[model samples]
Target chain A: EFIRKLWEGLLVQSKPPLTSHFPFPAQIPPDLVDKLERLALVDFRTKQGLECLEKAIRFADQLHVVDTTGIEPMDSVLEDRALYLREDTAVDGGCAEELLKLSRKTVEEYFVVPPGNIPLPKKEERSSMLKHSEL
Target chain B: MLGLTLKEVSLAFREGRISPTELCRKCLNRIKKTQHLNAYITVTDELSLTQAQESERRLQRGVPKGPLDGVPFAVKDNFCTKNVRTTCASRMLKDYVPPFNATVVQKLLDQGAVLMGKTNMDEFAMGAGSTDGAFGPVKNPWSYTEPYRTLAGPEADWVIAGGSSGGSAAAVASLTSYLALGSDTGGSTRNPGALCGVVAFKPTYGLLSRHGLIPLVNSMDVPGILTRSAGDASVVLSVLQGVDVRDSTTVPAPSSHAELPEEFDVRNLCVGIPKEYHALGLSPDTRAQWSRVADLFEAAGARVEQVSLPHTQHSIVCYHVLCHAEVASNMARFDGVEYGHRSSMDSSTEAMYATTRHEGFNDVVRGRVLSGNYFLLKQNYQHYFVKAQKVRRLICDDFRRVFASGVDVLLTPTTLTDAARYGDFTQEDNRTRSAQEDVFTQPANMSGLPAVSVPTALSSRGLPIGLQLMGKALDDHRLLAVAQWMERQVGFPSIGVHDDYRQCSDTSSTVQTSA
Candidate 1:
């Protein structure tokens, strides 16, 4: 719950970041803007806000605040709060997917695609006897 | 000689001087002769012939679609065309074909520009030179000397064309097509145009629609053109510019039929010289040429002043980080899945996807994608991506502040050194080389301001030299008009060496140092 609140607060609707603390701003290198937007959560109040949230997330991740291994069983919301304060991260907008991914079911969805497989075509004996020209 | 601007090509057809069929034939012939320049990845000769026949029928009916109606043109390979292979110059999409045309391609076809073929580019438009492309490097038509063998080998004697729009620039330079479409994230369009002695224009962001374009950086990837002249660029822009529902980024501004101020007066123009552009790395010969050109502008009554773009130093680092992030995202769509080339996924989905990408993409693109992923890993995104974005804002402010302070346009060299040998940019030291190459061009892109690189004169080695003119966002017409006027004043020689291949025999350094 603490991590959730922290994610919420960090991503809460806010103005576009004028500072470099976020992933994207009104002006950044085209490449960097591209980077921030890609990782950025689109759920922010504005496009700019989403970019900011991305930057904040990136900042925390770089500081080793985000545990990539997923080994710890600590509450996600609590983890987020620790990251928010400890990393001093600020995001102009919130990312819905990131928050959702911290939930139980969504984690499975992130790892799965269509599970069914296509069966190989089976040829009938009559069809197999057909010549190339006849076929 | 089919000496026709894209606009003139249509005019000629209307005047009965040439039929669209004949024009297509001529263009086909040129491509056949000059394809050695590696200007194209695929030549849809059959498709082009069919389109030309259809255009002839339309001409007979006296119903013209638009100015570009029946004008032969090519697009950089990154754009999707219904069934044509759109590689983005990487093996990842070597056999991939999109089901739909990019919004820009649709607009062009609707305006009646004939599709000649898809041109080559740096893989995913990532490199300064076209060397990083999967097909092969594009050769400069102007840099040709003798025997016309392509630098790629003895059978293909074309010179190194400037890139990543090297193919587009070379095509237009050699009359392979009337106009060619290119995408500019930085100086891609202008740099090649300058090196190839053509007019390349990157309009203000949102001026030209970017829908369906394979995204480089969403904000910076503006569709641009390489043509023979600024007026022709205007003609092509007229056909391509407008808000489209598909591309949400395009501005709602209607096409501006703004007239070129009848007599261009450089007297009222304020040209800013950023101190950062004149740093120590600039060659003496280049500096001399720059000074001479500046003097020419002054003699023509233009007011020139030195100014500082303080945040200029961070442009390269910021652009690289940002570009990598975008690459990481844009490329995610190419994971051998539903849309693109799929490899046998005997392994897990992620593993299969990784293997496909690893096998399919070239080294340069893969390196950039990995770097982008690393940069955005939760922790790095904040410090690198966010900080880069902030720096980007400062870059934009630098341009805004300069223009607001009475500077109508900013002038700088397009690249510090003329086209280096193709191998110079691929080594580990590429970061330094790339930085020097992008010095004058990145700021304009970072700010979303319009910039044009016009060929001013030849370098000491007979390579072309260009001066960039940057304008306030959306003020593209003025920059082009001024460029057109300057083009008239200092008519630079066309690097027409492909037709006369005896100029490049000697590989002496003096060739680069001579006037």
Candidate 2:
């Protein structure tokens, strides 16, 4: 229903499809669907996102027809090249001091986020979560 | 003074014929003269002059950083430059200023290369025609004489400076800068470089540091260079290399591969022309040019043959899936809390995130982000994302097998045609056009191989036609050496504003020999 509501009027009808309609729909449970879609952005698909997404789905479906049965999932093409790695140690990236200034709320030089998984007393619990930027 | 190549400009700077200040003024003046081209996002006029004067003083003291010292260059908007509003031609970063420079920019500054400004690009480097950026499309500097039946408007005659790095290509073509840095996920650098009649080089993945480059598809993204010739590209490449702790993907420079050789031998080398690249959509002129280039190599004593990578058709589909998924994940960092555009409307933090993203992102970015989330969903993950990645493995293996067969490099057209005119180019919606144009360039990025696009000939109307050369992962030096030889053999006139550049000038002569 979330996607059905969002998909109705969002796509541009002017051009004939460069590709066919996707053969399979996202087969997730209805409840989990909106939750993940929410994480991507609001499900409305305004700003041509719905069209953007529709194209990807159609292309992905086109790719799905080709048999990729035994192929291993590829990751880290660099790891294939035998590249050298820097040792893990703390170094100044100049992010904290500069970035903290942009946050609307902060506490004692640390940027603050709304209450979520972590309890306020334990700073280590928050520190343990990985930063997406680092990845 | 007006039409000198990057090497000639460097020589002039050294000989005291032109001071860095004078050189920068010339660049600024050139940019001013061609404002309709819309090549830059910001022009850094006073700051450029200040930096140029410093370089001039340093040269007077008899200590210069390197060959690039006192040279002026532009950077694609995607690369972050400190305090110099590094917008990726998107509203999200429309007013955001970086606290630090991208590693490549810092490296150039260290070499005393004057920063001219950030050039325009597709929003988040997502589009192919450089026409989709927030600042509007970059116009091709080439004489736009083509009267296409499908094209329209006041700029109808103007060919599109190929995109997402369209600004860089147009800038170098217009003589706004000596060289410009652009990011290539598939063919962003080379496409525009080809369209604008210049040399564009995408280094082997991870060779140049990606620390400050705004992420598009991180796995495929590499910092690329655009300049007047292959030799200038080699000069810029040596400066912008080295590992960074900030970006773990970068490999430490093996000292031997850093510098390109002065000369390369074509004798006894093997070149492959993939049969799959000879698709129906390739124009007759492009097809003939490909064969003529192969003949040139054969005549010069290198072995050239038709090779097959049957999986080529599936690459664009696989590339879209993989590229969209990564764009979704990378763009997640642009929420309202810390940096970038924050929404004014508030309900809860959830509403804030949604509104900010809706307001901040354009249709192209939001679409990919949404689809990425859908692909990564637990139920769809196996069917879409993983399958695409697995196909990527096949693509990688294709290059590996071909290289294993002793074909040192593969040759292909950089784009299907010469610079596309704006009206005809935009008539096809973004995604369709992007897919078709990227077909020839995607394999190199997908496999992490080095690729460079150098002008082979001009179109019937004076626009550039680029031919690409792909090489082994770390053998960038060798690839450039071969490209340099091709450059020497063609003697393709390097283009600029004041010079009388002709359309398809050499094709008349080559057509006689090949036909």
Candidate 3:
């Protein structure tokens, strides 16, 4: 008899109330999706990208109904313990060659990237531009 | 030998029954034979043999490093290994080799553990199913049928090895390696561990150093251990858990919890069965196994009670928000600057950056990055990111309140069901499937508690089903002790090697070889 009751109790406890699904924004605007693409630095301008974003947003919307008024936002799980600190020291240097070896394009000791649109002021104006920015 | 635990194999090495070189050769042979499983991304044949030879020399001298000495193990490709490619199963890093080893990998190698290979995983460890890698999808060993072995193509129906640590779980399950290192952000390790019939352990956050782990979520990611038994998991954890200057989040002192109690008594244990774990979509077999295990604890003179963690249902939603927000920030490093795949579309720097990311990342990774940036937008930051963090506190408080109420641990199903068919699993988008698959396992990640998935029984369909036990923060040893006890009682049958391959392994004489 106790076993039967235990089984029944197990069955009863297994069924918790389903998470309430509150209605969320039906669709994220395309402009907002474009902005997200720019910020993330990924091309999400396709149909598939928009669909993926919409699904993720809808899934995350479930958290909005949670009431967290008095609770402080948790940044790290180890907030209770003090993080370990060591004396400020320089170590693991002299690996510029090794670091440079990993890059596909390198000029001398520096990584090579495509030229930027910002035209460097003529060599004569470079010092003046720096001075102006500092001022 | 492949069927044995790390301790068992280590004992054999001490007894001089088998040498480390022989065991490594057998593992390499087995890995070769089971290539169809798509478990490994890169096999370090030369490195493994060389390491094995060194271990053999040490064994001959009658001086061993530790329990892991001469044991063969695999690592998930996400952890950087010096001079070896660590792809994280993404094209962005397909040909990229690291200049330094991850602290965890270095620690294991320092103990003389042989590195068999690097296993496959979801690209950048982003998805729930291991089907999203650039190389190919990993098929579950349990679901590999006779006909499919000969007839199956990439599109053929097969069971999924759960991800993002699917390859590690499959490797351990398939007996190709004694143990494998996996990383768990939410349920990446335990989800696959349950499906693959192995012990998957996620230590308390900050308990294990995460240096060079290739962060998925910096705040929640922990180096996970996957082995055939709880005892082996304990042995591996003892070697890897410590403070490292490379990762500042590590706890200051070495964890004494790595040492298991000499004798564990369940009579003194008070196990809490969190009622909220009995959530929707939990299969009948999973629920039955959960209850049976609870009954086993009660029968053994332990107090079993129902506890309510009201914030459990909100964890998945909260995790999505935080995970996406962090991913957006962390993934910003891969802009074709120094390492990783660089695009040749160098018309302009901005064009090059966008093109490189678009070509390098898959749809799922790009989707998360996009949604992550959306959540972090100035206007929506408070609504999504800040709100989720506050809800995260509530989730953490739920575990705290339960533990404070004299509960030694909480027992829940590791996954809602057994391993699913690739055809059926892919029916839903990766994001939807991950949310559903990770429901039970993510809460512990949220709370920063120690959790282990112990395979308890086979479902009616002949697939593995595991139950999860979560202990309070830093209570890893006791938690694993209980899991070890449960493992003994259950005696879950692990996957066996093929008879033909077993015969071949037995007859092959050990050869002294150098790479």
| Each candidate's interface RMSD | 19.2, 11.5, 7.9
TM-score of chain A of each: 0.19, 0.48, 0.72
Q: Candidate 3: TM-score?
A: 0.92
The segments of candidate 2 whose C-alpha lies over 4 angstroms from its true place after superposition are A1-36, A46-52, A81-84, A93-95, A104-135, B143-156, B257-262, B499-515
> On residues A14-35, what C-alpha lDDT tens digit does candidate 2 reach at each position?
1232354555653444445356
Lowest-sum lDDT 10-residue window in model 1 chain B: B506-515
lDDT of 2 at A84: 58
Give a tens-digit lDDT track for model 1, residues A2-94.
323322332343223122343443334545544432332111223433344344334323222222232322111111221111233563346
TM for every model, in the order presented, reads 0.75, 0.87, 0.92
Candidate 3, after superposition: displacement of residue B487 in Å?
Answer: 0.5
Per the 3 Å backbone cut-off, how many clashing residue pairs does candidate 2 have?
1
User: Where does the lowest 10-residue lDDT sum fall in candidate 2 chain B?
Assistant: B506-515
lDDT of each: 0.67, 0.77, 0.84
Over B277-376, each residue of candidate 3 has an lDDT whose tens digit, in order, gives: 7777889989888888888888888888888898988998899999988998999999887999887766567656776787788878888888899898
- Local accuracy of candidate 1 as per-residue lDDT tens digits, B21-125: 898999898788775677899998999998888888888799878778888999999888877889888767787767678887888888777899999887888
Q: Which prediction has the highest TM-score against the true structure?
A: 3
